[model samples]
Structure formats: C-alpha cells, structure tokens
Target: MTSTDATTSMFERIGGSDTIDLLVDRFYDRMDTLPEAKTIRAMHADDLGLIRDVLKRYLTEWTGGPKLYTPEKGHPRLRQRHFGFAIGDAERDAWMTCMRGAMEETVTNAAARQDLDKALSGLADWMRNRQ
Candidate 1:
C-alpha cells in the first residue's frame, strides 16, 4: 500500500515495524562505515545498540505507527537532545545520505520513498544547529 492510500498509514505503507528496524539498521551501518559520515559518526557511542533501539521506536511513531516512543522516553525534544552535537551542513548532509541509501534499499513503493525523502530532508535540515 502507498501513503496515498488514506486507509493505510505511512508505517503500513513502508512495511511496518520490521521495515523500520531494517531501515534504521541500514542507516547506522552506512553511517558507521562511510568516510563521508566519519565526523558525525564520531559523536556516537562505540556500540550502536542503544541508539538503534531508540531510533526504531522514534521512526515507528514518527511514521504513524504505534506510539511506542514517547511513552517510553517522553517528548522527543529532538533538537534539545541533539544540541550537544555540532550539527552543521556537513553533518546534516551525511545523515541524509545514509537515510537516502537506506530508503532506496528498503522502501519499494515509489510514492512512499518520495514522501519520506521530502519529509526526512526537512527534518534533517531542522536538526542542523550550526552554520
């Protein structure tokens, strides 16, 4: 199903929790290995386990799936949570590159991919805290 199918949620259109987990995994894998992501990757812990779970929950909820995140972590307060990190243009771009790669690999629906691309780009740009 596609997001255009109003009967379906973005989460369902994108293949539910399993797909979200895979996307998060692919996203972090790219971030962990790509030279372009090295700077941003350095800000993360050596082990991605915790962040991976958090992201899975966040994405699940953000995509109109079950409200699994806020119940566990309260408000996302995303910008505030990321304030300590110096998220500049480079960081945002690298992050988007990873996400784009993941989405390309996992999301089969053209419209769903396009929708996510637009939404995620805006969200990533919003995360930038520096010039």
Candidate 2:
C-alpha cells in the first residue's frame, strides 16, 4: 500500500532545476549536430549558453515551479518571439525531435512524459509561422 504522497509530482520527482538544466543542455547539444536542425540552428547564434538557461528557466515556470520566466521576461509571447523565424513543418518537426529526445533522456514518469509530449506537439504546431 503506497500513499499518494509517496509519489512526487513530475516537476519535483525529476529533481527540479537540475534535471531541467540537464535536459536543456542535451537538447541544445543535439541541435548543434542534427542535420535536420540545421536551419533552426542557424537562426540562433553559435553560443547556446544563454539559450539553454532561458529554456531551463522557462520550463521551470511552465512545469508548476516558481515563476521565474514571467517575473524576468514578462509575458512569454512565444509566437511573437518566434515570428522572426520561418517556422514550417520541417523546422517544427526538427525542434520536436530534439525536444523529444531530450525529454526521453531526462524525464522518468510515463504519464508526465506523455502529457508533456502531447502539449508540446500542440504548441509546436501552433508556433508554425509558415505553411
């Protein structure tokens, strides 16, 4: 008989910021080398340090942690921020591929992983700026 409290939330169970940081790091690392990610990769500067940090912070707030990103960056107009880039199906798919790989490597809970993946799939499609 396991108490429900014995189970941690995905956000807490994954070791919080540390796990998110590792995932973001691995995600950017994959982006650096994946041929499919070349176009999206080119959109970013060579240095991925800041990008990784921002993503980690963003995820922290997004996944029921402290409100890190909102206080620092204000509203996260995700679509507006990404509007500068031509995000077609290819770019969206590439980004999702990297994220999926990273998620698989970092996240442990089956339900949590599925929830995040489904949400991400919708968000990635919504971010598409091009046909």
Candidate 3:
C-alpha cells in the first residue's frame, strides 16, 4: 500500500528541493517555448530566472516544506500580486497548459499529479481578474 501518513507533506511526497526545482524549470521552459502558452508568456518578463526562484521557494513553503518564502516575502498575496496582469480564461488556461505539461513530465505518481492539478486549477482560476 502507498504511504499515507498524515505527517508527510506533499513536499516530501513529491521528493524535495531537487524535484521542486525540476518542476519549476520544466514549467518555465514550457511557458517559454510552447505556442499554446504564447499569451501567458507575454505577461512574464523575458528573463524567467527570478520568477523561477520565487516559485520554487513559494512551492517549497506551500507544500509543507521549510518556511523559505514567507520569511522573505512576508506573505504570498497571490491574487494581489497578480493584479497587475489581466488574467482571463484564456490566460488561465494557457498557464494551466504549461503547468499540466510540467507536472506530467516531472511528477511520476499518478495520485500526486492529480492532487496537484486540482489545486493548481483552483489557484489559477482565482488569479483571473477579467471576464
């Protein structure tokens, strides 16, 4: 049977810093090149390195790993932080396309990928500010 210990964080289940790094890297790489991600990609800076590091840190703390992000950033303020960008259904869908591809390529466990996808969908939807 699969280990379902309550104490186990998704961070641990998904591997660790290395896996998070790989996932973030793959995510941005997809966003950088995928034709489907073109619109969403335009929203980001040409240099993805900074966003990549922030995401890695955010995901680390978000998934119950060490508190790396909050200590530095105070709070994620996800929606407010994204307010500058006009996120709509198309943008959210495009973002999800890259994320889904990244998760599929990086996450080996089916159950874990499903869980991440569900949560990511909600978060991405919430980021949308436009109709």
- Measured by lDDT, the strongest candidate is 1
Candidate 3 residues lying further than 4 Å off, grouped into runs, are 1-5
Best by TM-score: 1
lDDT of 3 by residue, 44-76 (tens): 899999999999999989878899999999999
What's the lDDT of the predicted structure labeled candidate 3? 0.89
lDDT for position 5 in model 2: 29
Error of 2 at 67 (Å): 0.9
Cα displacement (Å) at residue 80, model 2: 0.8
Query: Where's the lowest-lDDT run of ten residues in candidate 3?
Result: 1-10
Q: Which stretches of candidate 2 lie over 4 Å from their true place?
A: 1-10
RMSD to truth, every model:
1.6, 3.5, 2.0
After TM-score superposition, the amount by which residue 75's alpha carbon in candidate 3 deviates from its true location, in angstroms, is 0.7
Each model's lDDT? 0.93, 0.83, 0.89
Please say which candidate is ahead in lDDT: 1 or 3: 1
Per-model TM against the reference: 0.95, 0.88, 0.93
TM-score of 1: 0.95
The TM-score, computed over Cα atoms with residue i paired to residue i, of candidate 2 is 0.88
**lDDT over C-alpha atoms for residue 51 of model 3:** 97
